[model samples]
Each structure stands twice: as C-alpha cells, then as structure tokens.
Target chain A: MSKTIYIAGLGLIGGSLALAIRKAHPTYRILGYNRPEKSQQIARERGMVNDLTDDFASFAPLADIIILAVPIKQTILFLKELAQLDLKKGVIITDVGSTKQEIVAVAEVCFANREIDFIGGHPMAGSHKSGAIAADVSLFENAYYIFTPTQFTQERALTSLKDLFKGTGARYIEVAADEHDRVTSQISHFPHILATSLMLQTGDYAESHEHTKYFTAGGFRDMTRIAESEPDLWTSILLSNSRAVLDRIEEFKERLDEVAQLIFQKNEPAIWKFFNQGRAMRQAMEIHKKGGVDSFYDLFVEVPDEEDVVLKILELLRGISLVNLHINEENREDSHGVLQLTFKNAQDLATAEVIIKNNTDYHITIT
Target chain B: MSKTIYIAGLGLIGGSLALAIRKAHPTYRILGYNRPEKSQQIARERGMVNDLTDDFASFAPLADIIILAVPIKQTILFLKELAQLDLKKGVIITDVGSTKQEIVAVAEVCFANREIDFIGGHPMAGSHKSGAIAADVSLFENAYYIFTPTQFTQERALTSLKDLFKGTGARYIEVAADEHDRVTSQISHFPHILATSLMLQTGDYAESHEHTKYFTAGGFRDMTRIAESEPDLWTSILLSNSRAVLDRIEEFKERLDEVAQLIFQKNEPAIWKFFNQGRAMRQAMEIHKKGGVDSFYDLFVEVPDEEDVVLKILELLRGISLVNLHINEENREDSHGVLQLTFKNAQDLATAEVIIKNNTDYHITIT
Candidate 1:
C-alpha cells in the first residue's frame, strides 16, 4: 500500500523533502499544506506534491506520517490544532525546527492522552537562500539529522521515521530535546547574533569614516556575512530560543571583557595566550569528509595577470578530475593573480597537485 | 642615474616590496637588512635584493631611499636609531606600519634636528600567509599605499618618494596620521578581535557539547576564519591600538546589548528594525574595482554531478576568457553541483555570463 505523507509548510525544507521522497518512492503520495492557497497551488505545479490543501481538519485523519516544517511558533500552534483533530492511530509526527525543547514540551502536552506519536527533529543543512525556488532534492545529502523523542514515543514510530528519511541520504543521531536546544544555541544561534553585532559595529564605524567602508576586505566581509540573513526567520528563532541565546550572550560578553581588560592593561603575555587559545581551538575542529556539507580543501596558485595565461592553466586542469577552480580576482592586479582551486576530498586535491607539478611551473600553496 | 634603496625587515611586506622594485627598475641597487642574517641570505638567494647587510649603521647612509617595514613598536625604535646616523643629507625615510599616529609622532621627534626626511606610509594589502617564502614581486601592484607626512616634510622629498613607488603600481593617497589610525582600527583591528571572541565563545560552548563542533558550517567558519591568524602579530596589533579597539568594543557592546534586550522582551518591531538596518548598511557598501586587493564578482551555475559533466562545463568556460573558475564542492552531492566563476572586472563577468547563456543550457545566477 502507498503511504500518505502530509508535509505542512511548503517552504525550502518541506518542498525539498517532498521532492526527494517523490523521486525515491514513486508510489508514495505526498500532500503539501501551506497558507494563502497560492503556495499550495505553486507546490502542486512544481510537482512537489501529489495533492495540496489549506485546510488541516480534512487531511489530519488521512496521513500516515506528518512533517511540520514551519517556524517554531507556528509549529506550536499547529500541534495544538492537530491535537484537537482525530488523527489516525499510530500516526508518526515530527518537526524541522531550529529549537526543540519548547516544541517538544508542547508536543508532550498535546499528545498526552492522544494516539499520535510526536518527535522533534532538525536537519543541520540549509542555505542562506529560502523558499521553494531554492529547494533541491540533495539539500540533506550527508547532512546530520538530529531527532529528539519523548519517553511516551513508540520505538516502531521512531524506526519508521528514520527509514523514511534514509532515502534523503542524511545521517541520523538521536538526542534529548533539551540537549539539542542547548547545543544548537551554542553552535548556530549564538554565532548568528555575533555576526549581526559585528556588522552593526562596522556599519557604525563606516558612517563616520567613509574610507573605512571601502577597506572592509575579505576578512570583514566573511565575518559578517550572516548579517544578511532573513529577518523574519531569525526574529522567530531568537524569540523562541530566548533563554539559551541570552545565556550564551552573557558568557560571550564575559570572555570578551577579559580580553578588553587585558588590552587596556597592555598585558602582552595574557593577550598572546588568549589569541593562541583561539587559534588552537579553531585548528582542532574535525574536518568532515563524506558530507555534501561545507568541508573543502583550498589550493592557491600564483598566476600571471594575462587572461590567456590563466585560461591556459584552467584548460590543463579541466582534463583532470578536480573539484572547483576560481580566480581570487580581488587579490589580483595588473601583473599577478591568485587562482584558487577547491576540492571536496583530500585525495582529489593531492592528485591535482601532482598533475600541476608535472605539467606547469606555477607556484601552488595549499591553504 | 640609478638610485639605491635600503629596506629593513625581510618579511612578507618588505621582501615583496624589494622584489617588486627590483623587477620594475632593474638597474636600481637594493640592499636588504634583517636579523640572524639567515633571512637576508635567503632573500638574496631568491633574487629579492642585490646585497644583504646585518649592520644598519654602516649601510643606512648609502641609500637615497630608506624603507622601514616592521611591526609598530620596532618601527618606532628603528626611527630613533636611524636618527642618530649623521651622513645622509636628504634621504627620504618611510615606515610601513599598521598604526600611524605613534610612528609618525616618533619620527617627528627623532628627525627634529637632523637632515633626514621622515614620512609615515601604510600599504593596505596583505595575505594570511606571511614570511619570506610567501613573498612575491607583485604583492603591491594596484594596492592602496597611504602616506602621512608631517608639517616639516619637504615637497621635493614627497615627490621623490612617490616616484620611487610608482614602478610598483600602487595607488597613492595622502592622509593625516591620526585619521588613518582611526579608520584602520574601525575596519581592520576591531573585526579581528570580534573574530577571535566568536571563536572563544564557540570553543567554550563546544567543550560540554562535543556534537556541537561537528555542526560548525560555512557561516561559522567564515566568521571565525581570522581566528587562525598568528598570535604574536595580533597581540602586538591589539596592544598598539588598544585605545581605539577598546572604544569600538564598548560601542559594539551597546548595540549588541540593545538587540539582546529586544530578544528578551520579544520586541518584534524593534528586532525587525535592527535586522533591516544591518541588511541595508551591508548592501550599501561600495564595491571596489581596479585594485590588486580583494574584489571579485561571483557567478553561480547549476550543473550535473558527474565528474565528466563538470569537466565538460569547465572546458567550455576555458574556451571563454574567464579569469577564475571554482566549484562549490561543499554544495555538491551525487546528483547536483554548482560551479562558481569569479572575474576581476564587471565587464569580464558579463561577457562570461553571456557566453555561458549562449553556449550551454546550464542555469546561471550572478550572486
């Protein structure tokens, strides 16, 4: 029998999940629910779902599995509404939210006397770009999919949910709801706030010193890139995970204040140790090998400024199975340029390095 | 008549300047001075300079131009020692340091009763990689070289120094020493500290939650990339510009604390306004063109995941006059990949985009 999977919120995650399941299981029927009716119509036109609905009451009883891919607040409201509905027995329900503790707590209350199984999930994979237009079947490939289940959750339902997501090529790890919220607050949410703060600080400085704006080079740009993130989405996240974010901020401020005091005292040894600690910690991050996520080895090659010379070098590399080649054009002048080549794996980079050494006289350095 | 130039400090900046000047003016004699004598010896073997000297007192009076390229503290000390030399009549003296006010002030006091001319200079070009091995002849080509001259500076001396650096193809800008320090502290020094603090915060978070380390993605990496910078170098910079750095930190903290309050109170309107402000300010930054400094236009193209398919697309682009091509390897899985092409100028990017549109069916987006 073909399973009926209902996905609420036809945005990037929901749309991509629907498409991935459709591609993998031709017989499974995917139904998408979203607001305004236009999004549902679009999702149908895009072939992301076999059916579309704006009303949840009619579809709640038909779904064997339900995935809520909305913001944290909306997901809570939807869980409350679903609790009032007569969902099928043994139905599996889950959510793709940035925070888990709040949502999982609500799920526990809503399903306390109900038959529906609720599990909180988060896929640690997404782009800055959002919406259905940016959706892809490969978004979750090799990504870590974290699941948080309550004591009331059934093992059969958890196993089935894992099997369903297996076709998306995600690695699964089960964690406690509170633990998921705390860890993500540290790694993802807190860093985002820092990026935004850095931008505002630089922007304030740029207002007085206009030339400083022009001097905002690669490092500054990279450090604050997340400042360009979606406002509505981030606001929802910040509000839902307020306690954890604020706690992390207080901890960060203490660390920064220590450095600030050291600078004021002109304490050279203390400052040296602080900087070395940061460097050592950053260098200790384990490089992910199999993920389609962000793990790359970069190689920089010095090339002459001539267009023909750079083209010739690319031509030579095109014959080899390398990953990506780009010119560091901003770092180039009229006489010299730097060519950056990226590889998904280290072996591919080694192979390209050998080929370049055997073929060209260009100086290459792996960064 | 050919001129002689003496450069103290054979690190990345000084060594590259020597090689660039040598390439442009073949007949000009260049002498390099560095400690331990081994660095100067290596520079000579690499053809960076004509002569190597460890004793600065014997060689300081022989050159028409003297360049002091060292850290901020060392640059000030060198100025005092150079002021004691009595042979030179009108030799133009300059030092390349990140902070300008202190160095320029020291130079004024040292050269008050002497015949030597002292001027402050800062070249706004550098790489994360340092040392003699990373030095190249074209490092300063099209880079911004700022000069701060005291009230006692001679017009003829300024003109002669400009003429000497013209061969290296650096664009010149004259500004007040205090103004340069203030602007650089805003854009460069403050951002470095923020990067370090973000890393420390994340490191603290990762200690208890080990799984959090694996979830650090592109945004986190980009924001903390400079955290891997040299400890001693950054220590010197933070201390030398401690006042400005601390001021900026206080200002930044005010803004961050405001946002944290809004998040705590669930002030949706205020949070929306703050995020929009950051986005607008980031969008308003002027894109730099025609510099050896970092600036590039990025174009993204969707391609199939096969190695041969990617190679074929690269081959097609190789036939075009594109400057740099890199693949977004972290974004690629078994079925989908995006290739990024970078161009030095806007015109070249448009040309390549048109060529790709005309020749292939690949979906392209200029980011």
Candidate 2:
C-alpha cells in the first residue's frame, strides 16, 4: 500500500532521511515542510522530496510515518502538537534527537491514548556541516541508528520503522531510554564536555606560559578537536542529558583517579597495563567495524604531508574502483598510515596494494 | 668549523634530527650510534650519517655535541654515563625526552662540575611509528622544539645549539624545567591519560549494555584516538612527569565540575559561554600556527566520503603548488571541510578555489 511519509524538519537528519527513504521505497510519497534552511531549499530545488507543505498540522495527519527530526527540546514540543492531531491508523512516529530519555517520556505521555506509536531515535552519523545541503543519501551508512522504545511501542511499529530507514545502510540497535542516555553520555555527550575542558585548561595554562599553544602536537589537538563544535548545540545536548552527563563525569573522575594513583606511585606495570588495555580495546573496536560484512577488506596506506600526495597515490590505483577511502583521522595521531581504504572484496584491495607499491614510493600497511 | 656531532640512539627523534642537520649544514661531520632497530638500520643504509659508533663512551671525547634520543629513563642513565666520561670541553649535550623536569634535574647533578652544558631539549614532534626507519627529514619541520636551560647554561651554548638545530625547521621556545613539565602535562601528557580513561570507561560500559561498542560514533572514536598509542613509551612519560600530571588532573576536575554545575542548573547562557570560550581559544590557536609567515593562506575544502574523491579535487588544483595539504582529523568531527590546504600566496589559493569551484561540486571555505 502506498503511504505518505511526512518529515517535520528539513535539516541534516530530516533531509538525509527523506533522500534515503525515497531511494529505498519509491512507492511512498515523501512530503516534507521545507524550512527557511539553505540545505532544505537546495534539496527542494534538487527535487529530493515528492511534495512540500507549509501547513504542518494539516498535512501531519495525512502522514503514515512522521519523523520529528528537530532539536531535542523541539522534538518534545512536536510530540505534544502531534498528539492532538488526527493521524492515520497504525502510524509510526519517530524522532532523530540526540538525547532519548526525556523525549521518550514525553512521547509515551503524548501518544498514550492515540493509536500512533512513537519511538525515540538517535542516528549517530553527522558531519561538522549542518543542513540538508550537507546531507547525503549515505549519511548514516555504516553508522549506528539507535531506537529507544517506550512501553506503548509495539513490535510492528519497531520493525516497520527499521525497514523504512534501511535505505540508509545503517546498523540498527534497540536500547531502553535511560540506558540509551547513559550509554550516549559515556561516549558522545561527556566526551564533548571533556574536550572543552581540556581546551579551557590548555588555554588557561597558555596565558601564563608563552607559546604553550604552539607545543600541542597531534595527539592533544586530536583530543580537543570536538571543542571546536558549535556551543549552542552542545549546550542543548548537555542540558537535556544532564543526569547521564553528570554521572559520566563522576565515573570518569574515578577512572582517571585510578590511573593517576598508578602514575604517582611510579607503578610502571600498572600504567602500562592501563594504556595497553585501552590500545587493545580500541583495536578490537576497529575489527568490529562493519561487522555485518565478511567480504569487505580494509587497507591502510601511509601518506606523507606533501602537496598532492594523496592524489599521487590515487593516481597509481586509477583503474581499481574502491568501496570507500576515509582519511582515518583516528590513526592520524601517528604520522604514517592515516588513509583507510575499504574494498568490497579482497581481490580489489590486493590489486590496489600491488599498484601502490609498484608505482609509488609510499608506505603501504594493511591493517 | 666542521665539528663532529655524536648522537646516541638513532630512534625517530635522533634519526630525523641527523637527517635535518645533514641537509642544513652539509659540511658538519655527523656521527651516530645506530641501534638494533629497523628504523636506524634503514637510516644507516641510506647514508643518513657520516660515521657509526659501537662504543658511545669511547667516542664521546671527539664530539662537539651529543643528543640523547633514548627513552626518558634511558636518557637519564646516558646522562650519568656521559658525565663520568672524559668529554670534549664546551660540548653541548641535549636529550629529547617527554618530561623535562626529571631529566633536567638529573642533567644538572651529572654535569655540574664539567665544562659541558646539559641543556634539556624536547622536540614536540613525532609519529606513532618509532625508530629511525620511520623518521623523516621533515619530521620536526614546522614543529615546536623546546629548550629547558639550567642555571649553569651560558649564552654561547644556547646560540650554538640553536644554530646547530637550524636545519630542523622547528620554532624554538625556551621554558624552565618545571614550567615545561606543567605545560606539557596540560597539553600532551594529561590528555593521553584522559583518552585512555575514556576508552576504558566505554569498554566497561559495554559490558552491561549490549551492542554498546557498535553504538560509539565518530565523536567518541575521535576523543579516544590517542588511546591506541604505545603503552611502554607512555608509561615512562607519565612516571617521569608524575607531579605535573597529578596537578593537571586536579585542575581538570575543577574545570569539569564548574561546567557540570552550570549544566545541572540549566544555565544555558553560562554553559554556552563555557563551550564558546573553548571554541574561540581553539580557533585562536589555529591563526597562530605558522605565525612567522605573512603570506600563508589556508583553504578548507569540504570533501565527501567517496572513492577517489580527493583525487578528483587534487586533479582540479594540479597547477597550484600548494605548500601543504593536511587531512585534519580534528575537523573530521564535522561531516565536512576536512582537508586543509596551505598556499604561500593569496593568488595561488584564489586560483585553486576557482579551479575547484569550476571543476567540481565540492564546497570550499577559506580559513
């Protein structure tokens, strides 16, 4: 049966999902409210969606699937507004918000008497750029798309929503609302706070010590990179997810104190164990990347910091079509082997490796 | 004035310094003891050094300068051994150690009565790859080379040492031993410990939360990138600079708690101020980077994740001889503008910008 998928926001997440859904299910009509955003305007100009509506409330009731891809606070407001609307039967409403617990609570309260099922969503894929202009069909590809279900949520709603977002090529994980907040706080939200704190500390130190900023090498720079993110967005993320962020901060202090004591006592073995365990765990994380694919092979190449260097490497492997080539900003802490290339099969990777070695003087390390 | 410069431990730092020195002052006689490491062996085979030493103490008397590029603990031992050796007068000895206070204190005790000056050196540049084989002549190029001078160090020694290392192309900063330790702990050492702690916390959180590992996104992965660094090297660094690291941890906790309070209170303006300050500081640091040059212009291009995409951009700017093209892993937090290209003049950058705009659909922003 043909259905209307009404997307409420046309920012990065909303716009990307519209493109992904359209490509995934051409039968469904994608009706979205194009805000005054440049990304949304550009997407409309490109004819990404089936239709546009300024009257969100009137058109919202026609949506079989409503995606609230607004800010966390606004998502709550949308849920409230969406609750009173006369929606289609068996409609599944979801959101792409950063924090889930509060939104899920509001969702459960709003949709309790209604036939519609609201599932909290947090798609963990985005770039520094915002808006639909920066949106791509593969924005969430290989990234984690999480679902936090409420007591009112049914299996039919969950599975249908998952199928709809499947075109994104993302890995799906279901988590409880509070548990989701705790986990995200441990990973994303708290890390942002820490990065900001580190920068502030370094900046404070630099005020007294001249040229201290100049001494921060690759590692320090990498750790504090997230501090450069937009403050208003982060402020909302932190405020909305306060409990989890605070708990993470407390937990982080304990973990840090443990290592600090080990260093203070001059316990080399313990300190080594601390760093080595982290290294081992981080390496393990890499192996689990793209876990669903057995045929995909990863190739890491060490590129030097020179003009048109990466171009030179690609020039060597011109004939072979690669699946993906990401500059592993993570591995960039080291000066070598920063480019991580993905191939759908081993044969392509092998051919690319031989071509790089035979044609260029660059160091090729397969990790 | 062709003087023999003996460098002990041809690791990444020592080997790169030797190469930089040779290219800078071709007439200088460079002698170094190559270790049983692959990096050193490769450097030796490449004729990066003029002479090799089997017995460092026996060859110590003939050198005008010596650089101890061993591990921090080993550097302390080498300093002790060199002190007792009948050394050449006015011989300047320096060690490339992470922690300066401990090593500089050791140097003062060992070289107090001798005519040689033991000026502590820490070249704030290195890759994840250790050993001389991984060393490049431009390893320390455009990096900070810090000097921690003792009370007995004279103007003659400082100037001569600076002159000798001119080939490194590193900006020199003179900081006191205690201040050096404190500053580095704020920027590098403390951040390393924090990164490890974050990874360990995430791993532990994953134990109870199913699929938690799969949920960690780019931001989390980026903040913990340095956790993948070597254990043994970091262990020595943390131990040698225990006091400063401990102090930094205390200060960090306070800074973190301040934000925590503001977040808990839901003071959005205050929280925004905290993060905005960090963003401003981090941005300020970038402007100061390569501050010596007046003609340098930086261009940031937002490249999408596609196979051979960067190659396409480089193809557009083929005629422009860019001074540098660095893949900023830091900016990878954002989905766009990851490639940072440097041009010596505004004309080249403007030309490259036009070429990119005309040739491709990629977004370009001048920073």
> Which candidate comes out best when scored by lDDT?
2
Question: Could you tell me which residue pairs clash in candidate 1?
Answer: A324-B327, A325-B325, A325-B326, A326-B325, A326-B326, A327-B324, A330-B293, A330-B294, A330-B295
Task: Report per-candidate TM-score of chain A alone.
Answer: 0.82, 0.81
DockQ of 1: 0.42
Candidate 1 off by > 4 Å: A36-42, A287-323, A326-367, B36-42, B286-293, B296-323, B327-340, B343-367
lDDT of 2 by residue, B18-105 (tens): 9888988899888887555565566678677887875768678889999888889889888889988999988999989988999988
True contacts kept of 2: 0.62
| Candidate 2 chain A minimal-lDDT segment of 10 residues | A287-296
Tens digits of per-residue lDDT for model 1 on A7-98? 99888788888877887777888887888555566587679988777886678789999999988888999999999888889899999998
Name the regions of candidate 2 deviating beyond 4 angstroms: A37-40, A287-367, B34-40, B287-367
lDDT of 2 by residue, A1-367 (tens): 7878999888778888988898889899888876655655667875667777666687897889999887777778888888887889989999998888898888888888778888889887777767766566777776778899866789999999998999988879888888888877887889999998998888888998886866676677677878999887888899888998999888888887788788778898989999999999888877234333122467777776555566677688775655455553333334443676676455688998898888777777775
Instruction: Write the residue-wise lDDT of candidate 1 on B214-317 in tens digits.
Output: 77777777778888888888888887778888988887778778888998898988887777777777777632222224545667888777656655655566
Using DockQ as the measure, the top candidate is 2
